[model samples]
Target: MPSFVSRIVPVYLRIARANRPFISTEGARRHIRERTLRPQPYGPPRRLRADVAVTVDHDRGWPIYTLTPRTGQPHGNVVYAHGGGWVNEIQPQHWALAAEIAVRAGTTVTVPIYPLIPFGSADVVIPAFADLVLANRIQYGEVCLAGDSAGGQIALSTAVVLRDEHQVTLPRTILISPALDLSLSNPEIPVVLPTDPWLGHDGGLVLGEHWRGPLPISDPRVSPLFAEMANLGPLTLFCGTRDILWPDARLLVDKARGAGVEVDFHEATDLVHVYPLTPTSEGRAAQAEMIAQLKTALETVRR
Candidate 1:
């Protein structure tokens, strides 16, 4: 059940309606970067118990934050990527979530500050992630990749690449409100257009332009929807009915199913994009639900 505040918070809904007609892939990218990229306030400072280090890869520096259990419990490992339309660094919110997952799952979490958009591609960041996995091979079992929004796209791409090109077996992937289609042309758009809260036609267009430079919108790397999912591993997707990416989520599920991939789709009613970021009661409840789903998904992979 949604709390009173969740029911009354109309900002996300209003933003969606106001920006609906003009939503384009490029516009969405730009709007997200502009609105969410502002420097986050320095959160309560506390050093993590896990080891932190930086590695230089192909002339670019990648920061890795590793969190391990204090009692030496062995568990699965996850590589988490932060979402900023691929244009922003890992923020405090990401760090907090990473910490929670690491502690609760009794696993080490490796967060790679992947290069953002307008400066990098999935081709660039995916291999860098694979390297991190290889370097830390002994630390984790049943490797899983997870992320939200654009980070979800990166995680999916990395899993695909690792399985196909690297022959590295990643058992599972968890995507929260993934932005899989850069083309923004899902057939369900008309039906989902009115309910989405944070994303709309206008914002999407702004974002798409910034992320895709000279490349066509249908490029497989830019739009995972067009990519071949034949060999992709088991997948779990969490989405909000009111999210602008709702249509994209549905399209992905259908395509994945058609491709013979095992997909678990969880859709929440009347929720907005990135609702887990909020501190409201509804947000906490949703977060708990997602975490439980993630645990079950991981367990299935282990089996």
Candidate 2:
């Protein structure tokens, strides 16, 4: 039987969904404008206080936000990628989370603004991220790559590419509600559709189409579930049972395990995708748990 909070969670999600458009429209538009009109040389500083810097990637410029610890030399660095279905979101919300992990794990965090789709290709963006990792490897040592949603896909793909193509070694990776399968035909979609407040099948399809362009939907780079994970680094994946991507997350875990890779998989009961970004108490708790898990993973990497 479902708990009382479980029952109420869906109801609250529905109410939130009804109001999301009005609540998010202005902020979304503002973000779009800032992402578009901001000069390439100058990256916008987030409201949060962190060491902000910009690095040039080929012809394009990328922002790197570094959050350092108060005590102790950094254990390792985390390269955090922000999620927006490959197009719509930015790195503002990630700053707080990055700081939390940095302090808890005694590490520094470097968050790069990877080029979103339609504007850049995964081939381009992934290599740029790899370059960032390679550039900082000496200062940061072994790095843990982390991201949510589409950003998660990028993180994992970049790790795989680095290991396989560039012979680079990443310590580990953390994925939150990762969209590993771009096919979007997973069996869990319908099961969680009624309760997911932020994303829908139609929305995913539209976004997928926008990002894929001329490529086939099954391209392994776009969908890491189909990619080779044989020698990838240890991975930690967090997904809610009520999320549409839960099935894909599970499948990815199974594949990683079968390939003899270490994986830490956490499935939160009765929660939705991107739950950490929600403003509810559940969201806060989820974000806290995520930070804890990331801290633990970083500690493991350091040891």
Off by over 4 Å in 2: 1-13, 16-60, 278-303
Candidate 2, RMSD to the unseen true structure: 4.9
Best by lDDT: 2
Number of backbone collisions per candidate, in order? Answer: 28, 0
Please, what are the lDDT tens digits per residue for candidate 2 over residues 70-187? 6677776788888877765465566667666777666778877666645766757777788788777877777778889888888887888788778975667888898887768997
RMSD of candidate 1 to the truth, in angstroms, is 4.5
lDDT of each: 0.67, 0.70
Task: Please report how far candidate 2 places residue 177 from its true position, in Å.
Answer: 0.2
**How high is each candidate's TM-score?**
0.78, 0.80
